[model samples]
Target: MSTTTTEVLAFPNIKAIINDNGTAEVVVAGNSRVVPVGETLQDLRDNALALVVAEAKTLQRPVRVRIEDPEGHGELIVHPDGKVESVSYETRPARHRTAAPASTPAAAAVEASDSAAEDVAPADDEAAQQAVAADAPVTRRSLKETSFLVSAPVLEPATQGWRGALTRLGFRMNPSAEELSEREDIRTVSQHWPGPRTIAVVNRKGGANKTPTVVMLSAILARYSGAATVAWDNNESQGTLGWRTEKGAHDRSVLDLIDSSTELLSPSTNAAEIAKFVHHQTADKFDVLRSDENEEGDHEVTAEEVDIAHQVLTRYYRLVIMDSGNTARAANWRRMIDHTNQLVVPVTAIEDRAEAARLTLQTLESRGGHDAELARNAVVIVSESTDAKRSMTGDALKRAKAEAQRIADGFEPFVRSVVRIPYDPALVNGPIRYEALQPATQRAWLAAAAAVAKGF
Candidate 1:
């Protein structure tokens, strides 16, 4: 007989626990790291949860463990954010029945919400019928599973958002290695970010496509996730980021925000008031904060000023991509690096540009501090700096391509990832429109952006 039980859990880490004996001691682990058997039901749940959360780091994916006991059965669901949802139900004592194979991971879809159910692509009718035919009769225990799964079920790889659906329909038939890698990158980029994250695009070398990276990456993140993102210029003096982007009505720059940061930081300031200093790129759906472009305005940005401005930015944006000046030793530049959670180092096809990027990584490592650790996990982007309308397949082009690849390859051990961007005439000079780039160039930028997002 199937029985119903009720239990509560937050992203529970315990996948499955079997009641071994009447002693009431829950032996939930394989190693010496075991939870002490508790005196009461509440005590048992708390102790088991502590053990599961601690062991969670070793698991590949968050699991929903169906905990079976003599009196009842409980289910624990762990969400991507590591939050646990646990449900307990009562079960009647009966002989055990054979359970279904893993193919029916979605079998517990009864308890899922309408939105979550919609996220699962429809299963093949023929396959569904076959699975049903081969399955045993649903027991009372299965009913409880259904209720808990509907409430909060961890999506398995077989039912992974879009890719799995395509695979099931025979859409993704035969994919090349690059195609597969790019698909994985896209999935990684589109992940749910809980809060604001920062990416600093730097090389300490001008003309390395730093500004373009900041623009392209932030645009991709916002366009795909529908979240607010911003590109910030951390130039100590003057920078052309504002020049290459669409200008707003006001001449507000980073300094304007920094000067008024005291008011901006106040809890009373509304979002509209705080947004006055930011230049919104309407087409790309991301904002830009540039340094003063005036020749006479020679005021240098200090490290403390950058911090104050950053605090204000975090209040309004989900992601921040900073473009640095040519000089790496500036106070603002170092501060930007300090606050950066992910580092993106851009290089070009030119040997000097590529070498300069490599040297920047080396210098970071030489700093012998947290910067060294950050450099080791940086993403390197190699962009072709030419102004060619079509891909140039000349011998010189081939050689440069090979050299750039070689340069990127050398950093495989130290860096998180490296991607090469093809030359696009549209990107050579002028205001960058994300839609204006060639299809190939756009795809390359998407790949680069995905790589940077994954580093976070």
Candidate 2:
């Protein structure tokens, strides 16, 4: 028979600090290292685990490490066989001590008896100390309230980029920092609120990318959240939202919806009935309610009609994104602002567009009520120049990028958030679809949507 003995190793202190800028500083035994791969809290933990596992392998023994992060403090045990286990401790609340009441004669007698017993049986000191500890006034919270549970399933590694390549070759490498950040953005936009929410996309200048912003935001939110979202064209007369989105078989518009608002708002109306006025984007998983596309129609959408259409849409869909016209003072546009829970201002990199966005915000602020509050909490999205094509020179593209950054910076102080979207020819024209967007463009839109979601 053969006998084997294994030794256990321990490291007393390992600290991981996760920063808001998607980086982590790890300290091990007074030595610190910055890990660039800590885009999420889970990433920070995995990086700490990898560091301890490597040391344990070299020492040929199981190791234990005390890990602390912003979330909580815990301990991790790494075995030489590459297995890891975690033990978490609950936090104890502060103990408040009040003056003890005068002890009764019986209590004094019991205490005297206990003191004599303790002195007589000195070998039971450890047990006596444990009893004292057990009676202490320490209130422990639940483990869930103090720290993350290690028993949760680990997420699979990346299947893209170099890590993905290694994964295909059976190397089992974790995802990169960029991939983890993207996943976090996706999770942010893929949330459901308590009730219906409306986002108004506005800019007083033509060619400010309002329509495309509405379409892309709706598409991203719908695709990621699986929620019923609608992009409504709130133009006074003729709007291009219908021209740039898919059309239904009957060519129904918001006018038709206003006409049937009574039936749609009724409790007996089925969810499918609202589809008659909406054009569903098959690939993007969202619906588009177009403006009055009839060339000969002389009627404009009035404020009352806007209210009716909005009530009907809100009854049917969980999210409604309104695409506004160039006029900020129009009745329908003002009504849209009244119904808005979140305000999004879209601007191209052009100077004129940027100025118009600033003016629009100022106009809203002058109203000095819900409009002013919306202006203060609005999110501004700056898109690069559409003219900078692949055939353009590097210098021109660089200039375009510089202009977009300038516009983004100008609005950052006034708005809650500012997101920059790169130029993509797919977004320049034609019916927009999420699947048709480039990978970089899609990621940019996803981030933009997440920023907007934060307002909710």
Best by lDDT: 2
lDDT of 2 by residue, 1-456 (tens): 111222344453555555433456667778877553644778876776766665565566666666655556666667644687655544334443322223644444445445755685778766775665455455444566433335333657888899999999999976665676688789899999989999999999999999999999999999998989999999999899988988878789999899888889889989999889999998899999999978686878899999999999989899999999999889999999999999999999999999999999999999999999999999999999785466667888898899999999999999899999999889988888888889999999999999999988
Cand. 1 TM to true fold = 0.64
lDDT of each: 0.73, 0.83
Worst 10 residues of 2 by lDDT: 1-10
TM-score of each: 0.64, 0.73
Query: What is candidate 2's local distance difference test score?
Result: 0.83
Evaluate residue 445 in candidate 1 and report its C-alpha lDDT on the 0 to 100 scale.
87
Write the residue-wise lDDT of candidate 1 on 34-79 in tens digits.
Answer: 3445456655555556555434433434455556555568676543
**Model 1 regions more than 4 Å off:** 1-183, 387-393
Any idea what lDDT model 1 has?
A: 0.73
